[model samples]
Target: MRVKSEIWIRAYLRRCQAEGVPAVVVRRGDEAAGAIFICVDRLDGSVALYGPAPAGIEGGETERRWVACFKTATASGAEVSAYLARQSRFDSDLWIIEIEDKQGRHFLGEDAIIE
Candidate 1:
């Protein structure tokens, strides 16, 4: 028997939601690209996102665009969370997160974050 990824994805998101995780579906344009989320499974504020592997010169480029949009937030240090939540790209589709660093890095954590 084969399992549909979209089905599993929804199940995962629902489980994450019940667990009080802050998960969101990251979309690019209007297609479901991926997601950036977090859950209680993580002790630190690590963020977990799942999507297509970064591709094309436009991969990182797309993330940069989102970074700029997320800059509008004035939080002391919650861009990762704010970004995944307020990003408008998901208004239609899912976008990929490709940047990494201490200031901000997309970490695949143990917990789940749902939107």
Candidate 2:
């Protein structure tokens, strides 16, 4: 069985703190099975959003890593924020994590993160 969503998120936050990277849960979702979205704040007025990897097609590879879903140009932080806001409206159960790191290091678990 898969781990609970809240448990996974808490562990992720702890890892971020241990790494000395500022991370916050912008929005909390269902404790058991909410989808997770991560926003990496590059600290340069730009942000990148990563979502859970998509499922594989028939006969395709099943294992996948987090995938980049959105990116804002330099100095477009507002745009990224607005985009996230819209997403929240659409999916209230989605968990949003904002990581403030110049290098955009989300540390989303190496085995499950491709980039």
Candidate 3:
């Protein structure tokens, strides 16, 4: 069984805080099983977005995998916002977490697939 979305999110927030990184939930969704989307604001003009990896990606069954949304390493804030807006419309239950860091650190560890 997978951990509840709310539980996972809370733990993630705590982890970020422990690392002295400023992170917050920009949008709340279902507490049970909502997909999570992370927005990494580099504190510059560029931003990076990470969303739940699609089915069949190789990873632990209970682990959450993420995929970068943009083809480039980073994209403009407007571009990411527009893509997120479309995603929000498509999945209202999805959760959004925003991390503001000058270094653009997402803190997703090895679960993130950039390519």
Query: Which candidate's lDDT is highest?
Result: 3
List model 2 lDDT by residue over 60-83, tens digit each: 143225766654233367866787
Model 2: per-residue Cα lDDT at residue 101? 93
Better candidate by TM-score, 1 or 2: 2
Off by over 4 Å in 3: none
Root-mean-square deviation of each candidate, in angstroms? 10.2, 3.5, 1.0
Residue 105, model 2: Cα distance from true site in angstroms: 0.9
Candidate 2 positional error at 45, Å: 0.5
lDDT per residue as tens, model 1, 5-46: 355356656655665555454433322333322221133444
- Candidate 1 segments exceeding 4 Å error: 28-115
The C-alpha TM-scores of every prediction are 0.29, 0.78, 0.95
Choose the strongest candidate by TM-score. Answer: 3
Per model, state how many residue pairs clash: 20, 0, 0
Q: Output the TM-score of candidate 1.
A: 0.29
Candidate 1 — what's its lDDT? 0.37
lDDT of 2 at 115: 38
TM-score, candidate 3, is 0.95
